[model samples]
Target: MTDTVADLIARSNRLGADPKNTNYAGGNTSAKGTATDPVTGQEVELLWVKGSGGDLGTLTGSGLAVLRLDRVRALTEVYPGLEQEDAMVAAFDYCLHGKGGAAPSIDTAMHGLVDAAHVDHLHPDAGIALATAADGEALTRDIFGDTVVWVPWRRPGFQLGLDIAAIKAAHPDAIGCILGGHGITAWGDTSAESEQRSLHIIDTAAAWIAEHSRPEPFGPPLPGYGALPPDERRARAAALAPTLRSLASHDRAVVGHFTDSDVVLDFLASSEHPRLAALGTSCPDHFLRTKVKPLVLDLPADAPLEEAAARLQELHAAYREDYQAYYDRHATPDSPAIRGADPLVVLVPGVGMFSYGKDKQTARVAGEFYVNAINVMRGAEGLSTYAPIDEAEKFRIEYWALEEAKLQRMPAPKPLATRIALVTGAASGIGKAIATRLAAEGACVVIADLDADKARAAAAELGSTDVAVGLAADVTDEAAVQAAVDACVLAFGGLDLVVNNAGLSLSKSLLDTTVADWDLQHAVMAKGSFLVSRAAAKVLIAQQLGGDVVYISSKNSVFAGPNNIAYSATKADQAHQVRLLAAELGEHGVKVNGINPDGVVRGSGIFAGGWGAKRAAVYGVPESELGAYYAQRTLLKREVLPEHVANAVFVLCSADLSHTTGLHVPVDAGVAAAFLR
Candidate 1:
């Protein structure tokens, strides 16, 4: 990369990496420099601006759009009015220097039309506080004096760019200007100067708010609105997350995120929270993620849990109705169809906030945006009456065709997208394979195993927290099982699929078997499956979203292998539980299924635990050839691998098998003795 572009990237990263400077993927940055034109062999001025949907902190040269400066400036001659501004984005393609680096964002015109070598546009909380204040224009004058100007509210497009360019021309000495009811844009002749000015502006505004603003901005907490103790607050959040996720998924399924941070609790408990939340966020970027407003539950923190849950259901219904009315109020004949009537952010006094999205990252970011909104509200309220963009303007931005087109550009989701799964004993062996497969198919997985470190390592291989998390759980202990289930709920919302894969084996004749052997095998396989299923069932049923329960029973469950009384009986128990639960949970749309795999010697924890030697002796073969010996007996004569069984779990839980529940899929290389019949 050229030094100019490299410097611009460093500047962008420094500004964007800090939440105090900008929210995730919220702002854009640009640098103007000369580059050799490949065809003409002449140096030409070009604009390198952050591309559409690119995060500034992680921006690279590939994530920037390069356009000929002359072509960009020429657009002003053919500039359409505000009504036709969106068309300008298409025009940017014609301005490309060559093949172009990335797709130009809507803010491209703002960066290109400006008269500067370096520019930064950010949504710093303090700056937005002044931008959204009721007396914002005057506040800008009082705080920034003539060094910064105030531009009236204008939706981002070619018009806003032209407006900023005009202001810069009028005030040559001014370093930047606060874009009214939006964010702050600063520019300078050099990259360092531009970054410095941006920080100075943001820091100055923050200092002003801190020094001059009135105290008790959020007002005192109401009677009974004090935050619940940390433990109770978290437990309450976990209990309510499933129901809230269900409500949020009324239109479509969504993953959820919960947070009871000090800031959120303080905001929710304050007397002024209801009014401020109802007025909604002012910044377009903030509202786009958080929604126009949050659904605030009008209940105390210490209320009865049962009452709180029932009230949440009632409040959720009202939230949807209100959202529908809002859509009706502003939708035009040409407006995009209503996306959904569900709120992205939900607020409960004393408890915390719940945010939902198609996946975990989106949900977590939505909550983060709301916290940014809360900071903006605090600043604006402290200085003057908190004011945001007009409701009509917010609607216009929320339903903008450009925004809809952006959504359309996103890749289609994977098969198990938005599905959350919990896999027991997933640190290694078949369980880990199942977890890996599920994560690859787009489900956020919880790798639960007795070995905590290995479970964590296995989960780490899957991906970030958005994809998988690991925890310790001994299925024999009911509390540990419940905690594992609850941890899944806390990590990525609620559970949609549970894989009961934790198992052990003992190959002893009935006469040789002791009570300890029978009980040990039964505890881990039979009672373990029961404990895990029961714990996860409460969450799935509470979510009211249909789910899947897959048991990794053995072929021995039905094959009646000799000298394996304890292991065989437990597998039988697991096999029967699948059938029985299928009958009981069909009304709730829960599918229960089993995968019966034999000769899975390689990578098999059971075999590695000495069961292979015992089984090899029983079959009168060397332990080294146990897998082949078992495979030779099958009709297909194929060795069963962990991946094969994982594939079976995927198919059983996949939409293709939505109607094929209460079934056993045998992944034992066509062993006729273990066939479903």
Candidate 2:
């Protein structure tokens, strides 16, 4: 062994002694040596690791062991049926019980699987901060790239060894493998280089995370989140195996590890914990090692393990009920099928992960992954928000034919290609009507309006269960416009169509029009449309999801309107805006168009004032005869309502209008073609 190994062992012992390393016992170190068995003429490469019951602070050379590397590898390959911890123990017993040497470290197999001459595993606080983040993988990839290979979280032992073997095969030149949700593993030709690499990776990742990621503030405990007892934890684990298998693979084996009833009860009794039962896995794959869901214990502080376990069973029943409710609300007949009762990974208030898998290694990976995911979720509460994969999308992946075929046979249709739409002024009038109609036809609608209350109420009336949300925003405000677009993603996942239906018009010719009037008209009718359409274009471009933008222009835009200079100018500008937006967003799969409507007067507060009487008098017609006069001017002579304009907007927003852009569709009852009567 090198002097660097001695230094690392000393440092490891100190770190284990610190109270901050409550979970440090979970890690270990090992070395390679040569040993000769007296009974046979066999020379073997010995892998010595820290013993299971020993702490690093007080560890001694006697605490380590010498095991045959070749034998260990052969045993792992042939007895893939053994559980991770069990396999490790069995391997240790085989080497020590008969031969008369100290037992090897629990991580002996992990050390043996690596190609490097030296290896070190540690779970530093800084490393955990990065590992527990939702974007941890991407961050790691950006930082390390091919320098490291990442194995999803799992339990420790024979299974982890297998995972390492696969990773080593894939990256023959990699310096080390970072176990997701667990800690960093560093390996190199020499012990010093391995330690240096491990330290550098952890420090670099920690600094980047600290600078880029905002930490969520710890809040008061929620009302009911707590830990559970061993018996209940075991039952929960067994129940979750089937569901976990469905999520990952039915052919995958399931195994359980780390169900300490005492630890669970102790965690629940801690005063410095959250109140609500926030159940989730440490990592995405952790569900495989630990069951998808754990039971939340809700007992008083200082409750005994037996009491907590009994209470946890009651809570488990409640969890099942709640899971059913969530399923009923979100699931459809076409939804993908899942195994087990619930898909949650960890019970709230529990510290360790319970993993399940087709085999021990896979199960360990699942457990480790679950632990990391849970930590990330907890850490992310305030810094940023996260939503799980969409229910429908989750179903598609879980019950996918290709994925299921690998395990068992199943039937389901591929997810249908669905359209998404964003409708401004959706609180009332044309916008609301259009939103309602589109949602009825199986489209996701994001309703944006200046009136927040009305928009929310409209969405509620339409059914909150539908993929729809009401966003309050002034479209003319660039920031607000961007936020609205983001809201579409945060709520409905993405954007496919934009309906610029919000506008304002004032009757004033050039001489009567004030700067304020022009500005106001421009703000809503021109600038507002520009802001909203621009934001939509950005999203569609990034996603490459072809989409449409429909501008609600006016008939006055093309034909002259007396005393309507501000209104008409803005309307004309809106038409031009469509042409410009279309040109820019076209290559990015977004099309822009406009709709000009005439004589459509339903629920417009614009027509409710004395201006209507003034208009009627100016035209030398009765107030009721105003409609008649406009009708006579058209060849069709039919009245138009807001619904007609909304219908026209829908057609332009639909895929039927694909390949059509920079055109204006007029819903005017043929008024533009009529000569003076």
Candidate 3:
């Protein structure tokens, strides 16, 4: 098959999807094509390369900037200076075919200089691990024989492009170039050859590491730090939420969330974790996401909660100073004046690691990057000292204008911006809609559900791991409820919104209502909510920032019908809790509200799960028309959607209804009977 721009992107995605090849969007790819110049009216060679910040896994034609090949190659002599990053940015922008598209990768010239139809520059962990080793060049030569050329570490731009071109000129048959202490670049006339070359190098380096690296043998799992035990870490994290979040935020607009995945905890537990983590990111390219280093904390299991919070604040101040010092000591005269915001990852001994991002997807990506860092760092340390490129190179990559351009490519923020949300029963139905709406509006949502697998599936559907987190928590279980709250706080820096949307209904009348029926309904909607609210309120109060706890009550709560005793009574009980808790939490700047939705049976799942056919029978309507039947009963005469319920929850948590708390809002297609009196 003829290699097209799409084919190039297809191979780039293969390399990007695996962290072993690239983590996040830390790689670039390009394809050579011919396009008709609008002005010249003649066919011209064009280079379509992955733009800066565009993830290869999701790259499309738009993400690949189009530049005239001759114009890009001419920069070798026409460009004013090699050392000026600003010059490189302007030159790349000026060479673009049009305005309105993404900025080309800083390595655009390098891709064009490859003298092949396809070019791929990847930051595979194994390749970087091998490249950063002490005798890297010699090892690279030994591993790839004469098929790959070795290029010493150099600032990425004019000089590096020129260097690669020279190597290809000197070694015409070379399949790739090993960028010592950095990454590797593979090129070929077709996508298959270029991808195969990249895979071969990564596989070769991974095999070498496997043969030589003898990792530290861990003892049987010891309980994590102090009498606190691992089970209590989530609550401790929740207790520490406000302070840690304050520490992570430079502007306090974004939230830093927590994850205690076994991977992070195992890294923390490993004997060599401290030394490995201190060495910084596995590759300098990763500094933009993981930050230069993580802030490490050791909390005494039995330490006073207030004391721990205060101590963390002090430590974070120290971390900022240390980060600034590191910058001052290594930053060159040409480096960016602004220090990037606070560290994206934090480590707490006995607890686990926390990763921060502007949103949910960004946070999860940052967290997962650190997990990959741990793996690479561990392997490198076990075999040899974990050595990445020099501090200067790391700062260059971290502060590089090209790297910052990726963030700038994104559209305007949604209303929630950096707010964090935790929604229970978020695996499907009404809860899922709430999570989706919150994330779409720029909130980092946590999918808290009884089904662990479904929660993860829900999280994955939201796009990036950073945008949504899935945690299995039975809300009725006090410990689990607290942990879910902690997970939200830890994952997003601090929690600002809570949606008590998880509930089950019995739909039984007074006489038919079994003891178990009443108990189960109350267990989830009432007791479960109490546990979550108590825990969440503590964190929000400590943050001193106004937040919302919007309970998903029911219209039936206000007007109970026949055979709806358990569900209606339980919902009504929680509806009262909303007013009472609202009054109480208002003193702490926390708003407690309720969303009473009815006839959302089709999508709410509460109605569809055995209740739909029964509800249709009661109303003497076909089950298929039950939603419409209920809709006509209301003043609006419109079917109440799950999204409508989600909107009501959003309003309760948002500035639109900011002044109203202890208020029960109805979202039941305008049910006059359910309206607040």
Candidate 4:
């Protein structure tokens, strides 16, 4: 890449990475440069702008759309009026010289039409504060004098780009302008100059707001609205997430994220929160993620837990009704259908914010955007009044055809998408494989294991915290088991699937088995499975969302294998627990099942923990041939691996077995003796 293009990427990263500058996937950056045309071997002036759906912080050369500047600018000749501006987006594809790098965004016109080497259109909270102020035009002049101008509100399209170009051409010394009720746009002769100007504008605006702002932008905290103690608040948040998730998923199932950050707590406590929140967010990017407004749980910090939950239900129902009304008020004959009635954001006075989306990252980003909106509210309230774009205007952008197309273009979700699972003893072997597979199928997973570090490492291997989180828990201990369940709720809202995979084996003959050996095997496999299931059941039951619980039993549960008294007994205990729990939990829409796999020695924790040698010795086979010996005995004569068991778990928990419960699926490569009768 040329230095100019590289600099633009670096500058975009610098600005986009910071939440103060722009939200995830919001805003665009551009660089104008010369590139040798492969067709003509002639130098051509091209515009490299951040592509549609690309985040500035992680932008790459490949994420930028390359267009001939001459063709881009020539569109002004056939520029339709504001009503027909959307048509211009399609016209951009015709401007591409040779193979374009990425799809062009609507903001392309704003960067291409402007006469500058580098341009930045950012949605910095501080700059947007001035942009969304009631008297934004007047505030712009007062804040930056004539160096920065103000342009009236116009929907982002060719018309807005033309308006900005006109403003820049008319004012020779102007460095940038606040796009009224939207964001700020700046340009410079060089890449460094443009970045410097953008930062200066944002920082200067923030300083001005801080200097001339009210002592309490959100107004003083109301009585009983202060944040609860950290432990209490988080505990409350964890307890409340499942129900909130249930309410939000009325239209479709969604993963959730919870935050008790100072900003969220402070906003919830403010006297002005109700009114300002009702007015909703100003930025299109902000509202698109957060929705028009958040659903506030109108209860104090000390309210009874049951009372608080009841109030949340009422609040959610009311929010849905109001949202439907809002959609009805503005939807035209050709407008996109109402996407969902459930609010994306939920606010609790003493707790924090709960944001839900199709996945964890999207939910987390939605919460981040709401925080940005709160900052904008603080600044706008200090300047004049927090005047966001009107309801009609917001509805227009929310239901825009282009946005609908973007949603439609999203890839199909995986089979386990939106499901949250917890796998016990998932640090390695079969448990880890199960967690990895679950995450790959789009379910957020918690790697719960006695080995804390390995659990964390296993979670990391899956992906970011949004996809998997690791926690330490000894299922034999009730408190530790409960803590693990709470942590899972705190991490990704709630649990939908539970895998009782934590176990150890002791292959001792009946005469040789000690009391300690019997207790150890039974405690880890049987008792531990019971504890995990009971704790996770509370959350799933509270969610009122049907869930799955799978027990990783053994082929020995059914098969009578000699010299394995303690291990075989414990596996049999686990197998029965699955049937018992399935019968009991079925009333609550919870499915319980089991996977019986034989001689999974390759990656079996059981085999690795001295059981392999003991069992191999009893069978008169070398340890290296134990798997093959077991495989040869089975009808299929195939060695069952950890992944085979993981696949069985996935199938049991997936929608494919929605109607089948209390069933034992064997992963022992056809152990007919171990098969359910």
Give the TM-score of each candidate.
Answer: 0.99, 0.43, 0.80, 0.99
Model 4 gets an lDDT of: 0.92
Candidate 2 TM-score, true structure as reference:
0.43
List, residue by residue over 131-181, the lDDT tens digit for candidate 3.
Answer: 667677777777788888889887777767778888988898898887877
Model 1 spans with C-alpha error above 4 angstroms: none
Separate clash counts for every candidate: 0, 41, 14, 0
Q: Please, what are the lDDT tens digits per residue for candidate 4 over residues 1-677?
A: 89888999999999999877888899999999998998899999999999999999999999999999999999999988888888999999999977888999999999999989999999999999999999988988998999999998888989888999999999999999999888999999998899889988999999999999988889998999999999999989888888999999999999989999999999889999999999999889999999999998878887988999999898888898999999999999999989999989999898999998999999999999999999999999988899998999999999999889889999999999999999999999999999999999999999999989989999999999999999899999999999999999888888999999998887778999999999999899899999999999999899988999999998889999898889999999999999999999999899999999888889877688898998899999999999999999989899999998889899888887899899988888887777777
Sorted on lDDT, best first, the list reads 1, 4, 3, 2
Q: Residue-wise lDDT of candidate 1 within 514-596, one digit each (tens)? A: 99999999999999999999999999899999999999998988998889999999999999999999999889999999989
Off by over 4 Å in 2: 1-417, 609-614, 622-628, 673-677
**lDDT of all predictions:** 0.93, 0.60, 0.78, 0.92
Number of clashing pairs, model 1?
0
Better of 3 and 4 by TM-score: 4
